[model samples]
Target: MAKSEQTKAKIIDVFLGLTNKKKWDKISVKELCATMGITRGTFYQYYNDIYDLMEQIEDTLITDLNHRYQLLPLKSPNGLFPPELFDSKYDYSPPQELFVWFDFCKNHQKAVSSLLDTKNGDAYFVKKLKVILAQHINHIMDYDGMPRDGLREHFTKIFIELHFMAARTWLDSKEEDFLSIREIINLLNTMRVGAGFLSNKQMTSPDFEAKMKFPADREVL
Candidate 1:
């Protein structure tokens, strides 16, 4: 890499290291420069301030994440998957994109973990991730012929929140023997399928129809 690019990367690396050691708000440009044996002027050339540096880092990560997700072959020109692809008789395989996403997370575990830390991390960054996940989930639900009504909308919100939190937990684990990406994907798929089954069963129940009615329309208990 060029000298300037290397310097910038080194700066980011130092910042991420500091993030792991202390709360984000407590990290200062002076300390970062001192740690890197660089002058404040050099830091200012690359970043306006600490917050600016953080915003740039987060923007880059989120942009890359969104691009990766957009590349998933969830739909064709018609914006829907082949109906047969959903058939129970057909053997199903997990999308390579999922593996890619998890691998990215693993590779950037330091940055991701630091940024997603509950107490000190950026909530805005987490919100951006959820937005990406929500879009992806909506596309999958669309292709799966799931209704986009109130109940399903609420379910989708819950689903996104659950998976995002699980991902954060996985990233936060310090153990070397944490679940592998493929295994986690399989578990997630199982949860999704189980949820779908319960949703279908619930929708088919007679009580579901009655529950859908206006509260006042129901017979008084």
Candidate 2:
């Protein structure tokens, strides 16, 4: 890497370290520079201020996440098998694409955990993640022929939040307490598969009625 890029990376690394120990508001540019033995002028060359650095980091993460998501070799609805084909006794595994995602999170654990910290993290970053997850969920539902009504929309919201909770739990856990990435992936896949089965049953029920009206302006994120 070039000298400038290396310097910026060093700055980001130190910043992430500080974020783990101190609240976002407690972090300052002076302290960051001091920690790296760099002058304030060098810091200004890369970022306008502390908040600017945070925003840039958040943007980089989101962009990379979206790119990775888009590259996933997701199958179409026609390629999906019926949920009935698998039972509780069946050995279940998540798609490799999901494993890739979990791996990314694991690799960036510190940055992700700090940015997702409820007390000190940016809500905007969380909101951006929700938007990305919602899009992915909607794509799956669309391909699976799931109805896009209010009920399913609500389900999507709950599903996304459940994932966030699971991720946060895994990310924040100690090394000794940490669950394997595959285990977390499998757990999430189980929930998704179970939900698929329930939704299929619900739609096929004799008394089923699609009465819920999704508001035109309702935002799932």
TM-score of each: 0.79, 0.79
For candidate 2, the 10 contiguous residues with the lowest summed lDDT are 83-92
The global C-alpha lDDT for each of the candidates, from Candidate 1 onward, is 0.73, 0.76
> Alpha-carbon error at 36 in model 1, in Å?
1.8
Deviation in angstroms for 208 in model 1? 8.9
With a 3 Å backbone cut-off (N, CA, C), the pairs that clash in candidate 2 are none
Best by lDDT: 2
Compared with the true structure, what per-residue lDDT tens digits does model 1 show for residues 1-221?
99888998999898988887787768899999999999999999989998998999898888888777767665632233333433452223554545656776877887887888877777888888878777776765554455567766787788776666667878877657577677888876665566554455455666866665678755575
Steric overlap count per candidate:
0, 0
What is candidate 1's TM-score against the reference?
0.79
The residue-level lDDT of candidate 1 at 6 comes to: 93
Q: Which stretches of candidate 2 lie over 4 Å from their true place?
A: 77-97, 205-221
For model 1, what is the error of residue 93's alpha carbon versus the real structure, in angstroms, after optimal superposition?
4.4
